[model samples]
Target: MNEVMDYKFVSKETTVNEMIRGKMRNIKVITIGVLEESTGIVYPHPISEFIKRQYEFYGKSL
Candidate 1:
């Protein structure tokens, strides 16, 4: 038997003074889905475009 789970990363941008004002930044939501096989192993989709985009951005920064 196997189980599957999903993960997501969300980011937000706000002014430094927002903390003093007790305000939260607008969240940019990113979702990632994973598949768990019968071996209890999880893997992300190969065709996922987000992963590719992120990798490209990271490589550029480096």
Candidate 2:
């Protein structure tokens, strides 16, 4: 989502918001619904935690 949102980071027709709506939203579904059920990874955490980690990573990129 951050990459898609950045004009310089990635040049694409879709905005970050559009990618969030069209693509990124399913990340939680896939993580919690399928991957967790199969692999038992900790990615099944709360969405807020994921957003926090994204912001943390983005902060590092800056």
Candidate 3:
């Protein structure tokens, strides 16, 4: 028999920096959740529209 376990997805983010020309710059980061089931493993799931909209409300940019 196969046992099923519930998995919880935790979302996290970090700022990435790079130096170009002579100044440092930050880049935007995006992420998505992955799904796995008895059928197959999905590399990624669609990003949430709500999350995308939240970016617009941010007080500052990375």
Comparing 1 and 3 by lDDT, which wins? Answer: 3
lDDT per residue for candidate 1 within 1-62, as digits (tens), equals 22223333222222222232577554333334453433443344443445646674566310
Question: How many clashes (backbone N, Cα, C below 3 Å) per candidate?
Answer: 0, 0, 0
Q: List model 3 lDDT by residue over 2-30, tens digit each.
A: 43443333333535576868999985545
Q: What C-alpha lDDT does candidate 1 achieve relative to the native structure?
A: 0.38
RMSD of every candidate to native, in Å, equals: 10.6, 15.4, 6.5
TM-score of each: 0.21, 0.20, 0.29
Best by lDDT: 3
> For model 3, how many clashes?
0
Pairs in steric clash, model 2: none
Q: Please report the candidate that would top TM-score against the real structure.
A: 3
lDDT at position 58, candidate 2: 69
